[model samples]
Target: MSEQALTLKQSGVRWLWVAIVIFFADIGIKLWVMDSMGYGWANRIEVLPFFNLLYVHNYGAAFSFLSDQAGWQRWLFTGIAFGVTALLIYWMSRLPAKEKWNNIAYAMIIGGAVGNVFDRVVHGFVVDYLDFFWGSYHWPAFNLADSAICIGAIMIILDGFRSKKLRTSN
Candidate 1:
């Protein structure tokens, strides 16, 4: 980052505090779950008819993709996270200070990425909870970091479509 980029006051980088907050919140929740809860479906705490708090570890990507494979996915996902973080930071540094939505979205992704990456490096897998289910089917267990990333990704996609609409109408 150049001097101009380093001066966060004038760029979307100012929104990094959002990322920091998300990171800590994700980590904190994972810690609480780890300390207070037991692992697996048998130990799950039913919070609602459709939801549960279950402890599990994801050694792979979203929806536990490739989880059954060998251990190499850990390094692959970790590398991808680092690359994405760097790119988002660079993009944020270039954005004007007035751009809040995209900055926030990028920051959120950064936070979630960092949080999961921290888990991967420290625990050799990501800690997961927050199970939503209906009848015999249950969604893959995930944590706060995954939620942030999904929301942020959705926001970015929505913004892209919205920007296109605005530009065409102008």
Candidate 2:
């Protein structure tokens, strides 16, 4: 089939399954964590020397940016998620199906964004559980949705450096 003739469904949009899977996984894990774990640093469960499943509520964007605000950040973050998802879906529709890296990256962001959006809308915040620490310092707790978004963003950045021209070996 001609690349130009491909419909949305036959294009990289097909990769949205990755988004769906990510969304469900993010939601399911959050639900499980909410039900199975205690809800704060005091209740953290050590999974390794430097890792813990520590349930937390992030009222802001990544790394809890604006978390201490007077509660306006949630709506802002939700709006941003909607915008990002729309843009990603548009990009995916234009991408060729074989462009797995790009498509998957876009889809990952979509999934993760939507998953977090779901949390923000339904729970008034994002549920975070995975925590990494060292000695007396710690990284902000995050969740699977955050991981997917970060990975997708990294993939997009890395793809920018990929060589587009195929070279014949000497």
Candidate 3:
């Protein structure tokens, strides 16, 4: 194999640690929330004017898509998360070390995916606790895993724009 390919192979494995860390942190926080607050809105703690620590269980995809359906969504979402995690691992493995933003993005996605997958398998749903609201309007409750995934996605988009700018400048 070429030197560049070999270097990528060696260095790419190191980036997986970022995913592992995110997974552990997500799980740990979820456990803490579950233990401290139990389930439902009665235990919600208001921390700020626009923020609260509330527990919710998501049985479907983002924003509770298909949440009103029958029980099939749990397995469906779990399967999708597993598939996405595998794809992220493959993509991360192929990326060169110099692609720092891409590496971080993939790692965060992988970690978050695995974390939510664990919850689906063990609890039949994902536990969400972070709550943000503006007066009576509220954003959907989400957890650390969701936050990591969002951050990763944003980083990927920003990196794409940066890459495009660099290409045009050159």
Candidate 4:
């Protein structure tokens, strides 16, 4: 293959590796939490004044959106995650190798989505542990996959703004 084609292929492979790393790291952390805590809020390990490691099984989406609904939400979310991850992979494959931010963002999202999907499939719920709080207010519990997805989304938004600025400045 030509040098340019080879470079593009390499870039794609690098992004795939990033995704794999994120997926494994997320899964590893989750497994450790499950093993250590044994599942539930009863045994919380307070790490700091505002943080604690507490196990929570989220049956719904972010913040347990549809957790109260009958068991149908599990399959729905799993299907959505799979669909989104597949679309992101396709998008990443088509994106230009020079678009580093977009590529990284998509890879992170794909990795995180796949990790959560795996949990949903194997455990029937997403295992959450990380918890943050204030004197009288507490943030909803979340896991590494959620963090990755949030970071990836933020990067995508920032990249959009940067691209817009570059276009207008030209």
Candidate 5:
């Protein structure tokens, strides 16, 4: 009814759109990759010295951690994902108007988490395709959702450090 109320509603809508876009796009790509490549089909094509499109499936979290667990991890991760998504939505909804970057970071994390969570819920595993390697060392394989989460984390960290630096310098 009031101007301030209208503004708040619009801002909330915008953030909802952001979350939906990221979540849907991540899920769509992952589904396409799964269907086109099939599970465990590594269509390796070296994009650079360090990057490769190496397909893989992960039944657990980062670095295939917990992938070999005996039981119950699938449901555990699904529950965790749902909890994180709910928390992110609540946090993003409360973000001030000036905190657009923080909202964006949260959206990324929420969407990415949901994308992988969907896979875990439906298939009991997350599909990973992107691989990075250098000489004898290799990074963990990941997919679009993982990439989104990584970028979101970096943005949040940068925001925190930047604000801290500015406060100290002033």
Candidate 6:
């Protein structure tokens, strides 16, 4: 086997392992939360004044927007998730194996997307818990999957900024 081919194989194996671990962890947490807490049930084990453990179901995109649609949104979001996940997987595999943070960002996004996709496919909605409030204002409830996606987005942005700074410095 050529050296390039061997490197590619090793990278693919590493990415696969990373992806699997992320995917399974996301799914496993969701499953446990669902089974233990039951759907739309909030335990409210108050850890702070502004936080609560409240489970909510989201039938549409962020903030429950389009949740009341006559119906079509389910399949639309599902298709979008699948397409984006496919692209992320391809990009992740093509990245240099030594770019650890970039690889981490891609894997996180892939895992998060897969987790929400599973929910959309099975229940036609995503289950959200983790809630916060401030005075009269409240933030939308979200789950582990959404958290992962947000973290991934932050990491990607930071990575880009760091790379740009390095280029400019040189």
Per-prediction TM-score to the true structure, in the order listed: 0.95, 0.92, 0.92, 0.91, 0.85, 0.86
Residue pairs in clash, model 1:
none
Residue 134's lDDT in candidate 4:
99
Q: What would the per-residue lDDT of candidate 3 be over residues 1-86, giving only the tens digit for each residue?
A: 99866876676556888999999999999999888886787889999999999888998878988888887988998889889888
Residue 137 local lDDT, model 6: 82
- Specify the poorest-scoring 10-residue window by lDDT in model 1: 1-10
Cα displacement (angstroms), candidate 3, residue 10, comes to: 2.7
Q: Alpha carbon lDDT of residue 134, candidate 6? A: 96
Candidate 5's C-alpha runs over 4 A off are 1-13, 38-43
RMSD per candidate (Å) reads: 1.9, 3.0, 2.5, 2.2, 2.5, 2.4
Worst 10 residues of 3 by lDDT: 5-14
Ranking by lDDT: 1, 2, 3, 4, 5, 6
Model 2 C-alpha lDDT per residue in residues 1-170, reported as the tens digit of each score: 66555686678988999999999999999999999988888999989999999889999989899999998899999999999999999889888788999999999999999999999999999999999999989998999999999999999988876633323322
Candidate 2 vs 5: which has more TM-score: 2
Model 2 — TM-score against the truth? 0.92
- The residue-level lDDT of candidate 5 at 53 comes to 72
Residues 74-158, model 1: lDDT tens digits: 9899999999999999999989768999999999999999999999899989999999989989899999999999999999999
Could you tell me the lDDT of residue 115 within candidate 4?
A: 90
- lDDT against the true structure, each candidate: 0.93, 0.92, 0.88, 0.86, 0.78, 0.77
Alpha-carbon lDDT of model 1: 0.93
Q: What does candidate 1 score on TM? A: 0.95
Error of 3 at 21 (Å): 0.8
lDDT digits (tens) for residues 1-170 of candidate 6: 99977777655325655566767876787777677775553464456899877656799877887989975898888898789878877776677777778778877777787888888888888888788889768799887788878888899999989999999999
When summed lDDT is taken over every stretch of 10 residues in candidate 6, the lowest stretch is: 10-19
TM-score of 6: 0.86
Best by TM-score: 1
Residue runs of model 1 more than 4 Å from their true location after superposition: 1-6
Range of the 10 consecutive residues with the lowest summed lDDT in candidate 4:
5-14
